[model samples]
Target: MALYEFRCRECGSTFEVDRPMQRSSDPADCPDGHSDTVKLLSTVGLGGRARTATRPVRPPSPFSGGGPPPMGGGGGGCCGGGGCG
Candidate 1:
């Protein structure tokens, strides 16, 4: 499921809904109880990263000091590269 943002023309209300991609262009009743609403052309937040087709690009690993420790193994350093208590 993906989240879509819709702007109601009748009530000038902007809202988000979780639905399939097929329903993104389908007629949706306004949350304000209006039926004359139409989806507006708009830009979503976070640069539309949520809807981007590519896999999310993660930040560089802070564990460059070495490869990550063995999975499920106990480590004592902060993953963020700062000293751990």
Candidate 2:
């Protein structure tokens, strides 16, 4: 069984239901006893994660060292003498 989302037109309330895929598109009555009900868009569940073919890759960060390189003079301390190295 799959979980589906629904919206009640008469009560303007949204709810979820668990049902088979075949009945996923069927109109369901509001639990509040209203006749005006409509099926909302469905979203893929956690089970869909197993269907992914490849893992997404992320780019490397440029400042992994936490500070910029030293200036021209090797002995010269960084800008404000703040030990960024």
RMSD of each: 12.5, 8.6
Candidate 1, TM-score vs. the true structure?
0.44
lDDT of 1 by residue, 34-60 (tens): 777666565653473555567786654
How many steric overlaps are in each model, in order?
0, 0
- TM-score of every candidate: 0.44, 0.50
* Cα deviation of 51, candidate 1, in Å: 18
In angstroms, how far off is 11's CA in candidate 1? 1.5
lDDT (0 to 1) per candidate? 0.66, 0.70
Residue 26 deviation, candidate 2, in Å?
1.5
Query: Which candidate tops lDDT?
Result: 2
At residue 80, give the lDDT of candidate 1: 39
- Could you give candidate 2's per-residue lDDT for residues 1-85 as a string of tens digits? 9888888998899988899988877878889988788877655673454455787866533334334444652332434344565
